[model samples]
Target: MTTLGLIGSGHIGSQLARAAVAHGYDVLVSNSRGPDSLSELILELGERATAGTTADAATADLVAVAIPLKDVQNIPADLLGGKIVIDTSNYYPRRDGTIAPLDAGEMTVSEFVQAHFADARLVKAFNHIQAPAITDDAQSAGTAERRALIVAGDDDDAKKIVSGFIDAIGFDVLDIGPLSASWRIEAGTPAFGPRRDREELEIDIAQATRSARH
Candidate 1:
């Protein structure tokens, strides 16, 4: 995708916008407060970036749902139909309260988001990352100590596209299988840390166990 669209301008969303711009993708960033509220971030992102409504941003080539896990339903599905959506949210009961089904392990957080945006191709990413670490730790693609990010989705083509974006934004990618398998990298897993290198992540993903409970 030539343009990266963000539905939230918090830590993860802001960093993604900066990284996307640096990597040659124009970005449209939005927050619940509206475009006027994003003035500073737009200036920080420079010429390639613009502030728009959630709907406007959602219309771009690819969209990242970087809002809180409880807020996914607020994004209109009409704008996401047939689009490749990157889901960057993690469920923290202390923050998002108890999403019973998710807490019970009936489905991964990404699958829950997929149900909210049924027509969109949802790929889970950026959920386990800490933005401060991303800013300090990014390594060029093949650097020996480059860190890795896992993308989980059922759509191969959609996963391929998201993987390219991850590589461009300065990280390696490991397809940790489908969304059904995403709990392996969820908040409590080994792959969910703030300081893991590629080698470390390889071990983490491999050692990931099936937990029917998050």
Candidate 2:
């Protein structure tokens, strides 16, 4: 009965909640708007899901951050310290405003999130796929050509935990090295968006080139 905490209940967050509940994990869903706003979502998620404050969600066994990049600083860092956090954020200058480092190609979005969550075992995942794809594209284990999702983190154990969760929910996990190498699949890269299985994904990662930041 592991609890999966969600720090933002937007498209990605809500979709992940549905997937987690279907897989038997209790979910604590929260957003900047507060628990009351999530009542409709909670009822839709049925009994295993509870709407709570961001702080309460931060205390779950695993936490998923699906907020806009500009709002990352507002996440409860103190409570999330040492937690295995799955970061599913992508930087959009128009939406999140321009971030100097990211705009200059000096830091990956996940790295910026890591700096903020300093002590959290942060893993970059779910950022490359469409929000609906979170549940729609899941395939059982051993399904031939099963779609693969990429995960990057500095912690081996944390990556393993997140990878296991991804596998259970339907998809193969491809570790693309540490967070530093995560840029290989960021927004502009060939690895983002399109549905790719393990072999195809590896090729995309290899072909990834750092383009001038948008």
Candidate 3:
């Protein structure tokens, strides 16, 4: 069984934990607040899940970074090293202050995070999906049908690993090239959390993908 670690047991982290357990993966979840704070969630996740400190959680086969963008440094580098990290964080200017690279269109959130955690195999995912939508319903619901999940990473093997996890959780995986191209799927973009059907998501990602500059 793949051991999944989660740094930051907030909305997305908790949801990912739940989904992972639902798919039979062992999950270790934690936040800045400590394991005691997540006792209830751990209990709810049953034997498949456990709560630990942020650093401990970062040591699993797959680690998820779901905390606020500004606190990325708080996650110990040693823990994130050599792990495939799923980045679901976004930069909220009001809370994270002004990030010049993001504002200048120079780097996406995952690009900055990857630079900070150089040893980790960083992949941008869960950032484009909504908390409620991802947590609720198996894939899609109502008239919407099911849409694809977009993932961007520099490592093909790492992306394939994350893509398998994504498919297990219910949605189709749409590979969106590398981390540098992640800006198109970031929060404010046309493809971000649009709740489009699978076909529509394909179209959105296609339109958003920029051509390589010569």
RMSD of each: 1.2, 1.1, 3.4
Q: What range of 10 consecutive residues in model 3 has the weakest lDDT sum?
A: 205-214
Better of 2 and 3 by lDDT: 2
Please say which candidate is ahead in TM-score: 1 or 2.
2
Question: What lDDT tens digits, residue by residue, belong to model 2 across residues 115-189?
Answer: 999999999999999999989999999999999999999999999999999998899999999998998999989
Off by over 4 Å in 3: 140-145, 209-214
**TM-score ranking, high to low:** 2, 1, 3
TM value for model 3 = 0.91
lDDT per residue for candidate 3 within 79-185, as digits (tens), equals: 67888999997878899988887777777889899988999999999998777677574562233566678889999999999988887887877887899878777
Candidate 1 vs candidate 3, TM-score winner: 1
Reference-based lDDT, each prediction:
0.88, 0.93, 0.83
Q: What lDDT is reached at residue 98 by model 3?
A: 82
TM-score of each: 0.96, 0.97, 0.91
> What tens digits encode model 1's per-residue C-alpha lDDT throughout 89-109?
898888888898897899999
Off by over 4 Å in 2: none
Q: Largest lDDT belongs to which candidate?
A: 2
Error at 28, model 1, angstroms: 0.3
